[model samples]
Target: MNGVQLLLVIVGAIAVSGLAQRRGLQPALVITLVGFAVSFIPGLTRIELDTEIVLGIVLPPLLYSAALNFSFVSFARNFRPIVGLGVGLVVATALLVGVFAAWVVPALTLGTAFILGAIVAPPDAVTAVAIGRKLGLPKRVMSILTGESLVNDAAALTLFSITLAGVVGTHTLFANPVLLFLYSAIVGVAVGLLLAVVATVIRRLLKDSGLETVLGLVVPFAAYLLAEQIEASGVLAVVAAGFAIGSSSSRAGYQTRLQERQVWSSLDVLLEAFVFAYMGLQLRFVMEDLTAAGDSVWEIFGVGLLVLLVVLLIRPVWVFVSFGRHFLLDRVMRRRIASDTRVQERIRVENEQRIARGRRPRQFPVFLNWRESLVVSWTGMRGVVTLAAAAGIPLALADGTPFPGRAEIQAIAFIVAVGTLLVQGLTLPALIRSLHLSDPRQEEFDREQAEHALEVAQAASAGVYQRFLASPPEGVPPELLERMTQMVKRQSADAARDPDPDATSAYGEAFGTLYREVLQAQRNAVVDERDANRLDDDAAREFLEQLDYQEAAIVSRLGYRL
Candidate 1:
């Protein structure tokens, strides 16, 4: 597509997504279907992108935005399940799908079939996560799905490289696939951490919000390219960098934080819109190419439907087995702890010790209930990555002969992707509603913690105004000083009685430094609650965002950028 066409498609996709959202429909499904219908409108050119550009340009920012917002604490808490789905489930799904594909298509070799398997193995959970967020799915479920999306790409691409090598008659990148994966993961993490450190240092020194946001835009691409250059997993690199930067985000200026959030949020919507639109628009051309290659499009599509079924079926089985084992084990452990007095005493002592050390008591593993499992199982939808990987497949084999089933594989991949988006994505919200999944316990905990967090913030700011008044800054007018002292007294009294208190006074260029100090103190207190697990990360983040906005307004009104 030309530049004009691309712009038109993006605009149209965004408009469709907005309309779908307002009508309580899944935007991804609506956008993809709309694009497909538009493609058949007579003479539009094929919507295609270079595979390298898709992987390199389109992926990093989306991943980075997710990583930045995702709490490191939640990611670690759900680490096991994320790994199971992201790595273990992805590998299992690829093998099963490959087996089914080869059996159904006699002309395709096992190696080539595996290539198709790897390409479509990972479900792009972006749409699923977005739907869950809107529908009020449990926080833990959201974490697992979000974390899986981040890690699965790396796993799928690694398998893609391995299977692609086998089909192309080349030596594997490493003798042992396990070693290859480890090398990719380890080196990728290292590259991300290294770049994060450098980026953090530069961000601190820059001290300009606009410049910092510009740098934020650049970091994801740089991390991806640098890691890929060194044969590491670029996906991991971008994620790691995002996590590290996010952890230290509080140290950055408020304007920078606010601008970065808004910028990335818009970028995510724009990119996702473009991706689904491109997926739909290319379907016609993919079918045409298959026919030109002497492959029956209908036959290949039928096989792809079966592969899609395998992809859909394998996840629930794996999730149930893995998660069920944990659930049962947790039950057995709980019974034992309850039955044995000695064990109970030991646990009590350990809890006391942890409390003494200012740590939360050790939390037992809380596996998902069956309702949650069913919802998570049904959330498997595929999107742009699958199409991109299929497109990246080389057209010729090692001896320069045409790749046997290239067009057919691409067609199959597209079919599976669109099919899943339609079948699963469209129905996920209704499934979630039917299940009535709600976490009342977590809700109560969040309420209690939010109150405590508010108190902590008030306490932190309690002495700021007093300190300012006791030893007033030079050049203070007596009248203004008296006014400030009275405001400070009222704030103190309010903090003592009010559940939510405003501890900062009026803003002015002269008091800019004072406001900064007050804002910093409140932010630190809230972040401390977050670190201590007293406050939910999401709640803490929302509070932090308010503080950032307040500070940004102050800075803007002062006619200066910090």
Candidate 2:
């Protein structure tokens, strides 16, 4: 694809995304099927995607954007479950799938089968995470899903490397797989930390918001490349850098935060849409290769379907065993250790409402109830990571005959990825509806935010009023100054009372509506001035930026991020 084709794809994807958003559908799902349909149009050939470019150039920023939006606090809070699914479950699934594949296909060696397993093991939840969050999936569930997606790629990719080495005669370095994994993890993390520190320092020195965001873009790719150069896991490096930089976010200004957020969020949407569509865009090639493999289409699909079922079931099976066991054990031990004591007292108090409702007290499994486990299991949708790994598989073995069943393996991997997206992706709303998970603390959370907003508003207003009363600015009328102070007090107090996203708080929306009207009035006046030649175009633009900034601040603080 040249410049024009690439541009057309992006525009097409964006158009599809906009339409999907309007109809309450995931762009990845819609665009993918459409792209596949378009691929079959008369005389058009699909562009063969280079695995190196996809993995190296395209992946890091997407991963970095995901990491930036993820919360370190939430990740640490649900550390065990995320790690269990991301690393333990991934490794287990790879092993089981590899063994199963080798059993089903006698001609396929264990090593080659393992490569396929690793390729599809780690689930990508970019689409699910977005849709789930929008559908009001609980914060904890979203956090776990996001956290799992961020790290599982590193685990699967690492295993992919080890297994690939065995297949290609580079197995010497991976003789002890444990040491290789350790080296990859440690070095990746170290390099990530190094880049994060340097990036943060550079961000501090640069006052321009645009320049800061530009540096932010470089951090992820830099970390990934530097880590990969040293034979470490580039995925982990980008993740680590995101976490570290995100942790020090206080060092950034509001402008930088807003700018960075917009840029990364847009990139995430675009990349996810582009790559998923690319999956379908390459379907013709996959089908052609499978037809040439001397097997009926149905026969190949049978194998692919088997692999798909394994990928789908493996997650829930693993989750139930590991997540369930640890949950039960932790609750039992905690109950015994703190029986009738401080922690127990807190637990009882926390569950008092449930008790009042004639329900049994909740337990440690609250983080991932059985219902959540089912949903998470179902949401293990594969995206770019699986496809990239599959594409990276070598074309020929050491003897140069052709890697055994390369097309077959790639065909299966892509099928499972697309299949999972179709089955689980399409059914997610139904699953979430069935689960009916609710955030019991949502009201309390909103109340806390409202109270904090009030306190901050009060403190700032008092400080400003007191300071200005003692020493006023020159050329400022006393009446105007008094009016301005009074207005601030009124608006801030009203905003506190009406903090957004709480349905019960009508005042927030009311104030927001009025505030918007005011901004629009200012905008109208500025346009009038510009129309009358009282304001130059450049000056009008400057004024417009300020208005936009103010409007963004009000909306962001007074409403949900969406």
Measured by TM-score, how close is model 2 to the native structure? Answer: 0.78
lDDT (Cα, tens digit) per residue for candidate 2, span 9-36:
8788889989988997766678878888
Q: What digit string (tens of lDDT, one per residue) describes model 1 on residues 194-297?
A: 99999999999999999999999999999999998887788889989999998889889888988988999999999888887887787777788877877787
Off by over 4 Å in 2: 169-174, 334-366, 394-401, 453-562
Query: Which regions of candidate 1 are displaced past 4 Å?
Result: 165-173, 394-401, 440-443, 463-470, 477-510, 560-562
The weakest ten consecutive residues by lDDT in model 1 span: 494-503
Best by TM-score: 1
lDDT score, candidate 1: 0.80
